[model samples]
Target: MSYWRWLWLALKMIYQLLCCSVSLILFCFNVFWLFCNLAIPWCTLTLLIVCIASKFVKLQRSPNEKRLLSLLSTPEDRPSYWAIANRAAGFDAPENSKAAIKKCLARGYRNVLLDAGLTSCGEIVLANPKRMNVAQQSLDELQKLNITEYHPMGSQYEPESMASLRQFAEFLDAEADQATVFLRLHDTSARMLDQLQKFMTTDEAFTQRTVVISRSPLAIYQLRKLKPEIICGLWHETFLSLAILKSSTLVTSIYGAILRNIIAPVIGISVVFLSKEEINLHIADLWRNVGVRPIVYMVNSPNEKRYFQKTMKIQYLTDSLRSEPHLLMKA
Candidate 1:
């Protein structure tokens, strides 16, 4: 054969091979997608059934609680009202602000949960989830804004600027030596996690005292991958209205169940922070069975506080430490 003819044939053969390969890949992908569509509903239904059944089946505490408690240095006979400050006592001061954290420390609250996200300049700052533009602003811009105005009792408190995570760590170091900071991650980007990893690596004590929680399972999974020693928790709510899914209590509950039963274990989470409304003997027992500590949040009512502390025998997140006089007395 002529050289040009052979070259043309060779190019044609390569092109044909490429076309076939692409076709096979597309075919496999479609098959996989079809399988997922067929299987996911049945899987979800089965998980829902299991979740409902879990309510009736109560199990004793798994041996894993001892190890987790030891890691956290929590006492066996912890106070019934042992509460984590939600957004650093948000009711007293601007949520996720230095003032709020200071208020928490003053009220004898050592465990404070604050929202954290990365800024446009890549600095990690304490931010409110409601602020959609937080990630778009730099640290200086964020610090200039008066976050107190967004608070419910904004007019009552002085204007407060947004605080960075470094500032928070320094404040804790200087003021509350025994404080444990729970950072609920709002930014789940790789850069954010990398910066956090660096921060944790620099301060061994900070890493030891810090607990990272997130509503995103992927964030928790990635965080655990980055720093295996850091304690992580899955923040779950029974009903979160998502635009993608029809906002129904049942759908949300099933989604939460899938995360709790499947994703949480795979990610090696030590704790699960469930919303107060979802707290039940069966669900709490299910968590205990897997050695994961279950905590309820936004628990402010006296009756609810007593129920969780006395009846459930679990810790919780409370907005106002001042309102819980019984807790103050215990302190």
Candidate 2:
């Protein structure tokens, strides 16, 4: 072999090495830049939004046309709050059960937050319980409430049972004024999307109403690729421990809210499930950003719901109206 041939090979190897090194350095810098500039200051911004901005903007609502139950719901069909209720009147109804889901629909809730997640069998099912948290909760519910517990974490909790993904879809097909279902994904959306593709191809309304909300950015990203037409949301939140106490509610809500706001454009997230704190300021920031959607869960009271509607001027996720649902309109 010629010396020139060997030299040519050596140069090619050196060039390849140079390219790889540059790429690695660029990747590291990008990550560092995002962490320093975006992640850290977001909490501080939440404090500002909640403390400073919220004080000025008033929630100007009129006399009659305010409360949800009072609002002449049929024509509007799809309202803001999505009930996270169950069957057995949501008291003992299992999460994502046929009875519980049907009851929520029967009562005219157009949006529902159903716990649709992956189970041990690799099949999509309902019931959100930590294997760790389930046993204790089960014992408490069965003992105090005198009702059988549903959503027992593992078999040990009590013969663990969950509705299959297919059952959930079929039930939706049978329901009237079909709801916008929020599916909480525990794993990769890729697998679920594959399972859903058959339904999506044939059912138009099913595709339109379902929204996949996930904590995994990759899952949400993959979901978008599979069904771009379907609505999707990213569940984002990284919080400080002291952010909870109500004295700091203003600080935490605003701080977490701002961090969430900044995160939207960078990752192309529009709909989001923010942490349950910072109620007032979070809504305002998300509301002001015309394109971004803010959401929450488990609010079930007349006065509390009224406060959210009139003051925060935001929608929430609820479990049960509990009483005559229409009474909310009276005030």
Candidate 3:
């Protein structure tokens, strides 16, 4: 056989191997999603499965696929918070449970947030082995910092009923001065948007003393139309600890979002909110700007918190950690 022919055959074999490896990886991810659904619904299942099977269909790559791949390969210096959340906390509610809250507080972070609906049976069983009202238990720890949890907007799949909101409202009404409510919006439809508007509008207290997470642009626009007292600007991406070291631009934007959307709404409007991450690579590096507080996370261990704080020079740290000084001991 000619030398050129042999080289061509070797290259073809390598290409086939690469393709097979990629296929196997996608297939395994599909199976893992199915397994996860055995416990909780993984909504992306159908889309993911279809994509996997369609690999055999050999359809020409659509523009959407090209765009998605481009986005995926955009060389994100910082990993997604969702990915880190899963890795650190097993995609379970334990990460947000009561013990986790206490641990996080002990780490010296004055402000924190939680997803109220994300609860763990372990927390219910262990924290209050007596099965105390877990909600109240959460409220107790939340009192320490400005905490907000979002109830998904659409179906009952992740829904917090109006009754739950009412209960939360009551909690806020009592501590209107000390604590503020952060409202999270889900992938909502037009009808859902209208209903949410009605709910917030009917109650002046709810509208005035609330921070919102508007997932969609329409949701943000609609909520503003209702003239809710405080509409948290959309935070499409949550700040992750890794992001601080990777891209200062990304971190600065997140800091600005928290200030404008999260902090300012809760504190007051006098606060000037700018795209901190977008403005420059570093707040100090670019201009002498103050009043910027950054959000950073610590997932694996308490010691990681100190490492992140020193490495990123983060002013704040969010973690599902217990208050143990030894936990944050030098990494």
User: Model 1: residues >4 Å from true position, as ranges?
Assistant: 1-81, 149-160, 239-258, 325-331
Per-residue error for 211 in candidate 2, Å, reads 0.9
Task: List residue ranges in candidate 2 displaced over 4 A.
Answer: 1-89, 131-161, 189-203, 242-262, 323-325, 328-331
Q: Write the per-residue lDDT of candidate 2 for residues 160-231, one digit (tens) a residue.
A: 234566655776777533555667665554656566655566776665556666777666555555555545
Error of 1 at 221 (Å): 1.2
Residue pairs in candidate 1 whose N, alpha carbon or C atoms collide under 3 angstroms: none
Off by over 4 Å in 3: 1-163, 175-177, 238-294, 297-300, 307-319, 323-331
Candidate 1 vs candidate 2: the TM-score winner is: 1
Compose the digit string of candidate 3's lDDT tens values, residues 1-331.
6999999999999999999999999999999888886644554565456445544532221213333223222133322211112111212224333323232223332122323221222111112222224333443343343211221212222322222344555644653332223344432455545555676777777655454544354555455545534444343343334556356766556555444444333322211212223322364332223222333333344454454445543322233333223333433
TM-score of each: 0.70, 0.57, 0.36
- What value does the lDDT take at residue 45 in candidate 3? 65
Clashes by residue pair, model 3: 103-321, 103-322, 104-321, 252-276, 252-277, 253-277
- Candidate 1 lDDT, 135-197, residue by residue in tens: 888999878888889988888778877778788788778866656778899788889889998
